[model samples]
Target: MTANGTGINGVNGAAPAQAHQAYQYSKEPLGNPRPIRIVVIGCGVSGIAAVKMFKDRFHNLPVELALYERNKSVGEPGSRTVTQGNPYFSRVYVGAPELYEYFKGRADAYGVPDYVRLEHKVTDVSWNEKMGQYGLKIEDLATGKTITDHAEVVINSTGILNAWKWPDIPGIHTFKGTLLHSANYDTSADLDGKVIATFITPELALDLAPKGRDTVYSREEQDKWAEDPEEFLKFRKRATHILNTGFEVIVKDSKEQKETLAMIKKQMEKRLSKKKELIPKLIPDFALGCRRFTPGDGYLEALCEDNVTVRITDIKEIVPDGVITSDGEKVELDALICATGFNTGYLGVSVAKFPNYFMTTGPAAPAAHGTFIPCIEAYIKYAFDAVERLMREGIKSICVKEEAVADFQEHKDNIVHDFVWTSTCRSWYKNGTVDGKVWGPWPGSGPHFLESLAHPRWEDYDFKYRTGNRFQYLGNGRTIRELEGGDLSWFIKKGPKHTREELTPSTVSINGL
Candidate 1:
C-alpha cells in the first residue's frame, strides 16, 4: 500500500500492469474556457469511484470537484459496515476490487477527508436554465441553517439504502417491548443472549446468515448427498426445520398483483397436491428473489445461548412488555429488533421518477456496459474501446446511448431467467413493479460487472452538452478565458515539498479478521 508518485497508481494492492492508462484530453486543455465544475453527491462506493476517476484522468486540468456526504465519513453508511467487516462476502459480491482499482490513484493524490458534516439533509432540487446550473436546497440538522449548492454537473450517487421500509402489520406500534430496525445494527454483542424472531424470507435470511450457510441445496447437490436416503432424509428434514425456526417469515401472498397471484395460486394447488412436503420448499407466498439476501451472522447460534428464545408465529400486536401473536399467545421479551429491509422499486431522483429524459430519445447516461451490468460485459468492452477511440478523436464527456438500456436489459432479463437462485424464495431482487420493470442498471455478479465497467463506447450515446449550446472542439489548444474560468497554469506551479514519513499501523481490532 505504498503511495506511488503518480496519484492513481497505488492503494488496495492493485496489480501494476493493470493500472488504468490516463485519458488524454483533446485540443483545448479543457473543452470550455471555464473550469469543469463537477459536484458529486454521496461518498458511497459508486460516488467515490466516479469522483476518483475524474480526478485521476484529468488532474490539475481546471476541474473543480466537490463531494457532498450526509454521513461523517466515507464507507460508514448503508452496507459499508457489513462489507468492511466481511470482505470475502462483500469484496467479490459487489465488485469492490474493480472499484478499488479504479479509484485508488486519485485517493492517493487528494486524500479523502476523515470526517464531514453529518447534519445536513437535502430536501429539494431545482434547475436554473438561465444560470445554466443546478441547485440543491438543504437544511442543517443541528443549526437549521438553510443552504444551497450550485454546480454545473451534479451526480446523484445517494445510494439505495438511505430509506427504510416497514412492513404493514396490524397494531404493530400498539404493543412494543423494544422495537428497532436492522439499519442501526452495529454489533451482535447486545444480542449475545436474547430471544430473536426474524420476520423475513429465506433469501433475506441467507444474507444475514454466515457465508455458504443455506437451508438446502439445489437438485445437483441433493443427488450427491442422496446416496444414503435415510440419512439424507434426516438432514433434509432438519434443514427444513432450521429454515422454519431460523426466521419467522410472514408469508404475504403475492395476491397484491391479481393476475400473477391467481396464476401462482393455481400452480401452487397442483404442486402442493402432488407433494405436500414440498409446499414449504417450492411455493413461497411471496415471489422468490424479490428482495436482497439478509445476512444474520451469529443470530441463530445466539438462540442456543442461555436466556434466549425463538418464536415462529404471526405477530398480533406490540403490548407494553411483550409481543402478542395471532395464535392467541403472548411472548415476553425485553427488546425487539426489526431487521425489516429497504424499499427498492422506486429510487428518488430516478430517471423514471422525473421526466427529464425527454430531450432526446433520453437524457445523457454514462456508457451502459461500464457500469455494474453483468450480462453486458462484452458490450461494455466495446463501449470503453469506443471511449478510448473517441478520446483520440478529441471527445471527452461521453453519454450512454438510449437504446443501450434496452439492449442491456434484454440480457439482464435473460440472465435473471437462467439463474436457479432467482427461483429459490421471495426477496428484493425482483422488487420490480407489478408490470415487471427493472429498477437498477445491472444484476449481482462481480466478474460480469467488471467486464461491463472496463471501457466506454462512443456509439452508444449522443455525446453533447447538458447546456443548450453546441461545444466547440479546439483539439488540445489552450482556449480563450471566460471571467470565472479555472487556469491550468495553477497545476504547473511548484507545490510545497514535504518529507516522507514511515507508514505505521494506526489501530488494531478483533473484527479485522
Candidate 2:
C-alpha cells in the first residue's frame, strides 16, 4: 500500500517525510556543543556521589564539574565524630569506615579527587537571570582568599547535622569545668578520673539510661560479608527485618508498642536490679520509639559508677564548679558534656527565589527512619537525573514547581501523623518546633522513598531551553547513531532470550470471549 508516495510494506520503502518544515539543520554539531558547568557544594557522601554520577554518565559530553568542601577532607563534617570509635548510634548494617571508604573509593575511581577544592566554603549563591547562570562567592579558609565563580547548575550537599545547637541554660559559661558538645566529643579517656556530667533531654536520656549490649561481629564474619555476596545479602535481609519490626510497632499499632515497652522495662529492671530506684527516672512516660532510639550499650552501667550520676532534673544554671539543678541543688563536676543535638528544617535545596538549585540532605530528605546511606543514594540519583535531563535537552535553567513541593510536603505531613515521631515528645526531629511539624522522618518505608525518587516527574519542573521553543530539544529528524554511520536497524538485532515464556491467555479462562 502507498500513502503520500511512501510504501507501507515491501522490500523497498520510501523515506519518511520530515515532521516539521521549520526544522533546519543549522549545519552546527548536534549534542550540547557548549560546555555545561556544574558546581557541587559540600564534599560529603552525597556530594561525592553526585560528582561521580555526573562524571560517569556525562563523560563524553562537554561538562565542567567542581566540588567544594568546607572541611579539610571529604568526610570531615560528619565522620569526625564517628572516627572517635563511638560506633554509630543507629544500626548501619555495615561498618562506618566501610561506607566512607566506598564513597571515597568511588570518588577517586571517577576522577573526582582532582576536581575537589578543600577548605573552600560557599558563602553565597546568587543567580544571574540575564546570563542564565549562578554566581557563587567562595572563601578559602587556609589562604583567606575570596573568589567569585559561575556555574550553569549548583548542587547543595551540605548535611543537616552541620549546624549544632546548644541548649539555652543560663550561666553555662560560668562553669570552670571543661565543657564540650557531643559533636566535638573525642574520647571517654579524659573522663577516667574526672566527674563528668552529660546533659541530655528525655529522648536521649532513655537510650543512654539503659545499659544495652553492643552487637560485636568477628573479623572473620566481616571478611565473609565482604567476600561472599550471598552471605551479605542474607545478613542484610535479617537485619532489615529486625529493624522493620520496630518501625511497624511505632507507626502501625499500639499493642506492639506496649509489648516492646514492657520488654524494655523488664530488661532495664534486670540490668539495674540493685538500683531499682533509677528506673522511674530513666524510663520515659511517653510511648516508646517516639524518638530516635540509640543502642546505649554500657552507657547505663557507666552511670552506676560511684563517681557518675544521672541527674534527671533540668539545669537551672552552671555554677563555678558544676551544674545547678532546677531545685537549686549543686552537683560538683569537673567537666560538662552537652549531648544536645543538631538543628533541623534546613532543606539543602533551592529557595523560591533561587532556581536550578538542588540539595541532597535537606529537611525534605528521608532521614528519621532506616539507614541514611540508601536515602542519600536515592536523593543523589533524583537530583542528578534532573541535571542529566537538563543537559540533554540543552535547557538553560529549570526549577521545581511550587505545587510539586507543596504536594510532597502535604503527603509527608499526612503520613507522619500515623508515625510515632509525631507524638508529643521533644527531640531533634522536631527541632524545637511547637507547631507539631515533624521534619526528620520520611513518613514512608525506605524502599518506598527509593522507588518514588527513581522516576522524577518532568512536568513538575519549569524549564528554559536554549531555543525559545520548549520542543527544540526534539532536535533534527536524525540521531547521533545515524550521523556517526552506526547501524540504522540496530533496534531489530536480537541478543539473548529469557528462560521464562511470555504470559498468554489460558483457553480455560475464555468465558468473557
Q: Give me the candidate number with maximum lDDT.
A: 2
Against the true structure, whose TM-score is highest? 2
Candidate 1 on 36-143: residue-level lDDT in tens?
A: 455556665544454445545655565455666665545432332222222222232232233344334434444554212345666666554334345777777778
Clashing pairs in 2: 347-363, 348-362
List clash counts for every candidate, in order: 40, 2
How well does candidate 2 score on lDDT at residue 486? Answer: 72
TM-score of decoy 1: 0.54
Q: What's the lDDT for candidate 1? A: 0.43
Give lDDT tens digits, candidate 2, residues 65-167.
8989988767533431111121222332333345556556766776777888999999988777656688889999999999888887788887877777777
lDDT, model 2: 0.66
Badly placed stretches (over 4 Å) of model 1 are 1-33, 47-54, 77-110, 114-117, 186-198, 201-300, 303-308, 345-403, 421-424, 432-445, 465-471, 475-513
Question: All candidates' TM-scores?
Answer: 0.54, 0.81
